[model samples]
Target: MGDEVPGVGAHARYVPGRFADQVALVTGGGSGIGAAVARQLAAEGCARVNVADQDMDNAESVAVAMGGTARHVDVADADAVDALVSGVTRDCGRLDVVVHAAGVDDPEAKAQLLSAREAGEPVDVLARLGDERWRRVMSVNLDGTFHVLRAAVRAMRPRGRGAVVTVGSSAAFDTLVGYPHYAASKAGVHALSQAVAKEAIAFGVRVNTVAPGPVDTAMAARTPAAVRAAMEAAGAIGYASAEDLADSICYLASPGAANVVGAVLLSNGGRFTV
Candidate 1:
């Protein structure tokens, strides 16, 4: 940690020098947990941060606020992800951290359940709980992570040093009935990160995952009140905020976590206590 860190505005927590001079690229950096992580990293003194998202306007707002750069990237598109990586490296000179936080919720699944309760609609035949939904969820959560990690490793291996923090979900290890697809994709993310860490150790790269539980983000806002209450009651600390998860991501991206490779750091307010 250092004094007078770069991008810490009034609201940031303890400023840390963990990422001084590092260049970080955060996907889905426009809002919620991704945005919080970006702000935290910038506050910690990373020299350059590329805040990327599918929405350029949102991304630009975040980047500008953070005093960083913004890039529009569709993570599902491997070519676009590669180009974004190349562009960031070309412009910034080096890459040190990669944080993938892009994600989506199953609105259709939620709708079907709501309809079943309200109008006696058959929940099994919901339009949103099908193959297409599964594909989209996996495409962004798992495949998108792969695309970014692939490009980042290509850049990091040459330097022989880098850190990657992928965002997973507590659902990966728990039973989340309506969001089976989301849970499966996040589980795949954990497995993928572990495999990457195993292969990358020799190259001096570390890959880890952060599986957050019921974070107070837009996603959590969409959860039913009863479900949210249940999650909160089950947790030792009731709720975890985006910044709480961001702190863990920052730690994984730091030199202090050098020995912490291929690990899944759970920031779930004791919801999935080991």
Candidate 2:
């Protein structure tokens, strides 16, 4: 509705009963794509949705609106992540679906890089990258994935069935942003997803990764307007929406994706089509 865009139209509102009787958990469900996915699950008749996020206020808001539950969790902490899954499994009586959408973006560091560039200072992104930033990013993006997937795998093992969908970035493959740490962490997520999928399949559990591009999110705001516009135009759909991404995720977690495993669904709006 914004500009008579060819592929743009009213958002798909509901997938009624798509997840009836299911219990789902979404990390980073406070806002953005995570919140969208959680809401979609609830709309689709999920028996329960655990809205896990580091932001207590936002998480609580989303949970209350959806009539789910909120848990303040830092995905970077393995112990916390494990405990979360275990508790959810205990409360829900079964963990049927999990979407690892939780991630981080250091706006402060981005501001520094831009400020240094404006000041005519040499901006060696890698050389200037701090060890702390790299570690923190990896911990949240890669290690956090490990913690959740591993614990979920174990829980699903006893049930003999479950589905896990992870959120990866298109940066894992080709991104012009030039943020090595973030890119690498996402790449790790890609590989980890594939490996975990292969391992979980033996126990009737499925895992997949959704790598989206040019998403209109708060994190993407840090990029220059020109850069963002160019990226959007390059995509086949001309833009990315959180709801669209959630659809792919829901599909993967649903029985429709039963045959799909160890695959990375590159939802780039056909920007890098195979």
- CA-lDDT, candidates in order: 0.85, 0.84
Q: What local lDDT score does residue 116 receive in model 2, on the 0 to 100 scale?
A: 56
Q: Write the per-residue lDDT of candidate 1 for residues 1-274, one digit (tens) a residue.
A: 3344344464445466668889999999998889988988888778998999999998998898879899999999999999999999999998999999888878766555555656754555324567888899899889999999899999899999999999988889875656688888999999999999999888998999999988898877886665567678978887788888888888888888999999999888887665
> How would you encode candidate 2's per-residue C-alpha lDDT over 151-252 as one tens digit per residue?
889889998999999999887878544478888999999999999899899999999999988777777787655546767787778668888888889989
Candidate 1: misplaced stretches above 4 Å? 1-8, 113-128
Q: Pull out the clashing pairs in model 2.
A: none
> What's the lDDT for residue 211 in model 2?
93
The estimated TM-scores of all candidates read: 0.91, 0.90
Clash count for each candidate, listed in order shown: 1, 0
When summed lDDT is taken over every stretch of 10 residues in candidate 2, the lowest stretch is 1-10
Predicted model with the maximum lDDT: 1
